[model samples]
Target: MSPFDQHQPAAKPLTVLIVAYLFPPLAGGGIPRVQKLVKYLNRMGVHTIVLTVEPPPGMVEDPTLLNDIPAHTPISRVPLPRWMNAFLGLWRRRSESESGKQDGTHSVDAKLHETAQEHGQARSLNMKQGQTDQRNTVFRKGPQKLKQSVQKIVGHALNWLRARIFVPDDEVVWVRGAVRAGMRVIERYPVDLIFSSSGPLSNHLVARSLKRKTHLPWVADFRDPWTENMHRTSIRWRLALEKRMEKSVFEEADAITTVTESFAQDFKRLYPARDVHVIYNGFDPEDFMELEGSPPNAPLTFAYTGILYGKRHPRYFFQALKRLIDDGMIRPDDVRLEVAGVLDYPGRSENRDALIALGLETVVRDHGFLPHREALALLKTSHVLVVFGDQEATAGRYIPGKLFEYMAIGRPILGLLKPGEASRIIEQFALGVHADPSDVDEIEEALRHIVTLYRSGALLKDIAHCSSKDRLSANERLCANERLSADERFTSEACLALEDRLRRFRRDVQAEAFYALFQSVVGAKQR
Candidate 1:
């Protein structure tokens, strides 16, 4: 028997098809969780086969994530249709053409001519610094009154086009290809269950089709909620459609899993009969080794490593820093807010405006979308790992995975978020402090607290002390966010302590929880 086989009680390993649209060779926040879960699941005696698409254009290329998966795991790559990418190319073009015909002086004739020019330019665009800003600045330069009117009309038309066409998302193209790949995997492996992970909720949509054909138990995993996301455009019609799709998956999926208990509760509330469980996204401790030793000439850095867009933007963080600079709470030269990801998806650093307005152009650095490993290394050098999410109704539910990454980093954290789980986690574990995302006063207080902590260097000492542990242990409050408090399962400190008592939230442990769920589905005999 394999060494891994001894870890599980199962008499026979249960094979599963993991239909994840986001996986290795493609780098994103979503990829690591799914990849690590597969790694640990396979090691825990669950045979795993991953079905994912070819690297979509513009996805960061990092081949290292593949090294973490169980070496023998089978990964089937479905080539994304060239036409769909072409269609999205058209989407970008449509935005460039209709986005901002602000000035009336640039008549409809001129606008049409300009639109033609943009369509041509958008055909094969390259991602370079200030590219998007230069594009937007072109249309924004026209008349004030006419610009407003033109913008109103153009923006509505564009939004409607997106809503009407990109129903669900751009990855709709991947569904057919994935379903076919999944069927082939099922044929080759004794797959007992179909596991679909989504963001391109298309993964579940693909599994939904396979479930209908093969009569297999389908497990639909929602990493992030579909309709309940605050960062999304809260269009009732769009949500109605997305909810319909979500419900279809819920009805088809034998088991539902979510990254957070809060999200699992949302699913349970939505589908009372479904088996909804919380299988958290976590860190693979191996990815982090001896962090680079502290360097001389290092400024007190506050690093945020992830996508920053919509409500998750660090505008308030910058505002708080600016306030501290004015109050002399911290010297501007002493602070560096290094953001590893872009401000928005199109690589447009929208927060650049906020940074410039706050006169923090010198203090804050936007290191757009570094590779996953590079981002984490950048994080290690910081005095504090900064997490930002707002209190928007839908954004309040789950702990962003970065909190786990921060806990693993063992650094003091500074949270610019609403009074959600992120804030509670910071306080409960002595990880950091939280400030309202938009409130300057509350944020300034938080900043002062963090700066004081940085000066004390207690967190650095704590991180240095936490040598073998994967993350915080018993004495530490599990470092989970306030939103975690809402999950009926996590109501008591005893529950929290018990969960974190033995080990931390490592990918292997999280995968063990998932393997249990898979065993439950297939009714495999315990050894």
Candidate 2:
């Protein structure tokens, strides 16, 4: 019934035990990738039993993503332990008896509320707007400031404690529980293949023990690098041990897969004797099939649709917009900035405060963590989309899972990335424009150039704007961009090429390849 779903001989069904730390109902970038993999793997005749964690702290769960899961696919979830929660997560109030209770130097929000009320201060929510404003002015940042100050003081010590503790990650505590649940499935059914995916290395660690015990043909999937990662703290001793652990997994894995080709090549060099597969992170085209198309006369808008905190923050974008308005390069009201995900880091709201700090709050809309379908709908209408990354040694290997979703919508993109895999792909497909994320001046220049094109009505022309049903056939629209002259930066022809390239990375295609590898590794096809 779908474009990718058509008449083809289904591959021999194999029972696959999928070990993943993140899955549907636990919202994040990684959830959809694994979710789609299971969806299409079933289409390709590979039955999967997914083992994942219960919803942990600070995740926006979208049960709608569960709609994408194939019916009858068994999902086994292991909850994080109570002691584990008390140690890693912030304090929770059991009752009014423990008011103003402090977890280290930081106090919980309930504690702050009681402290405020005790001082005879009018609480914001119960008071009038002006009174709320007064309360907001007096108490908002003071408690937050104290919490932040305390967090800063203990940040390094926490890092040291984390290194001593959650060696691979805080999620390691869930591995044993996951393995026990997985063994029940393995004993009940013949698990022909074992697959594990990770950003948190604990997922692989769980699969590692299972693979060793069961001696099943295992495929290790690394969504990102372990030792070379830029997102988390890397303690020398911990990293050295992880490298040893990484070596063991690589050595034992029958087939290894990574999201980026560069990372795959690195693993190949790490274990030259083993086979490595490059499976690019991509979008599920079917999800957008039922949505309405962007109507005409929509305001020029730029959207970033995932978590952007810490090093991934787009402060340069804000600075560029401010400078653009001041330099008369763009109108503040004519263009709008849309951010659709969580932007908090640790104790404070860095990304939120950044927008207010720049006085761009009115023009910049924060639709905090929408459901997957709603986020996709918002992205479909936008004139330009933003995909940004941090400055890191391994940044080139980091191709965000969302970039393909942006491309799938057939809109223009403004990527704040270095000249890495993501940038290369964007430039190759004439997706949009790119500027260094670390350089505000360069970002400002890129913004000016794109805004000029927007005013000239060129950016939207390259995108194949069609009704939802017409989208699949609208692939031909991107063809026109390829024939356009150099001046027509993102022509329809180039867009078509991007669309075609994207097909190779779609879930069904990638899952089919993975299934074939699974069969080959187990020698089941000949059997």
Candidate 3:
């Protein structure tokens, strides 16, 4: 039997307390990993009791995800104090309004920036705009300056307070309540192990407290890295403090699990004695069983679902799409791009205007913040699915959770990624086309290849046959002839082998890995 096969326990099932702040009905990138683990671990003779925070207002919510939890599983949801919730609600609304205004202005600024860069007129425009602003503000200066001074002082004080008070993360406030709730759950249930998944990092903090109190064999899971995370705070003192906290938590946990091998390696390097395992984020195959219909029809739709924030913006992808339309290689109406999920990040509004400025508003559809199931259905109906890596050098370390679902959807993938774990996965599986996200020209070429293969009715056939070398060498000049001969395609036997390889990433397989780790950790403690 495969190592991933679930082992049936002869004795009573192990019961684990799963501490995850980002569990459903909170919709996010972090939800699928924890939710799927809960779903499959329960089926594998492990009872899971979830410990999560009550959903805050204005956060994305999907009640549909709750259905994935096994019936009668215990869940303890710790809530914030009423005053704290009210303060957060008001703060969130204000932030939303400010971000909205910033997005609008960002679009306008981007247009100007683009125009200036092309025409070498940036200095001239800046000078002109500055002069106009000075002239306009001269008569209204005294009160404005006073207001600005007061606001700047308050902002500085708030930033200082946030830096100190929100150590590790803002979710630290929930730690006390969650720890109390967890203690109650342990008292009520026959909890055998403690598991926590991090993003807020407070989940681990809560588990750390419980581990101290009860001395349970604790497993801390990092969905993303801690101090080394790409989005981590840049403040020197804060970074130092976070590094210390991260070390302390990892040192206390009996086993540590992360979503990527790269992350696991990093953790091992930092704490060579710690037991670290890679439990990949994966798709529920059952979710895709019903989407196995015929390929989507024309207009050559390319869909991207999930939040577009941070450096994970689609500017390069949009630019590539625009270029294809401008060159008439792709007709405006015959091709479309569908974007789902929150697009409220900085420069994203500007990117939308970039689409319009480049005459592609009609070519790209924006479906903001779709329900998870609806997003999957839309992806199934699209000809191509796109995932953008962060433009930063560290982009390769992250394999977006959505990529696995795209793989299961079995469509031609347009991976605008760097040379990292994610790109290697696509190439290793012969999944689809990938390009350097930073390279507009390369992205355009990759998109061209996808479109060509789709039109020739050879996309799937070509994807299955082409090796990573073949794909990298394929250029615009060679796209049409890139399809290999009939003998070049994998045989039916070989195809089954390839499918077997992909099974390692199935949710059930991943959950089995988790169960094995849990058994070992618990057994080691007993010994």
Best by lDDT: 3
The per-prediction tally of clashing pairs is 5, 8, 1
Candidate 1 backbone overlaps, count: 5
Q: How would you encode candidate 2's per-residue C-alpha lDDT over 1-527 as one tens digit per residue? A: 33234423336568899998788776667776688889987877678999988866533467788988987999898998988765544422111112111111111111111111232222322432122133232212323677666666565455445556776666788989999998998998878889998856788889988988898888899887766655544456766877898899898877889888888888777888887888778777687665665723535678888756455777778888899888877666667766666344335555556667776655555455667787887787677889977666567778988887887776787889877899998887777889888889889888888888887877677554322335553243333333355675545555555557556657667776676667667775336
Q: Each prediction's TM-score against the native?
A: 0.79, 0.83, 0.82
- Please list the C-alpha lDDT of all candidates, in the order they appear: 0.64, 0.68, 0.69
Weakest lDDT window of 10 consecutive positions for candidate 1: 104-113
Model 3 segments beyond 4 Å from truth?
4-7, 94-161, 292-296, 345-348, 460-492
Alpha-carbon error at 486 in model 1, in Å?
32
What does candidate 3's lDDT look like per residue over 299-328, in tens digits? 677788865554667777878877877777
Give the Å shift of residue 203 in candidate 3.
0.5
lDDT of 1 at 342: 44
Against the true structure, whose TM-score is highest?
2
Better of 2 and 3 by TM-score: 2
Candidate 3 displacement at residue 118 in angstroms? 38
**Candidate 2: pairs in clash:** 478-492, 479-493, 480-493, 481-491, 481-492, 481-493, 482-493, 482-494
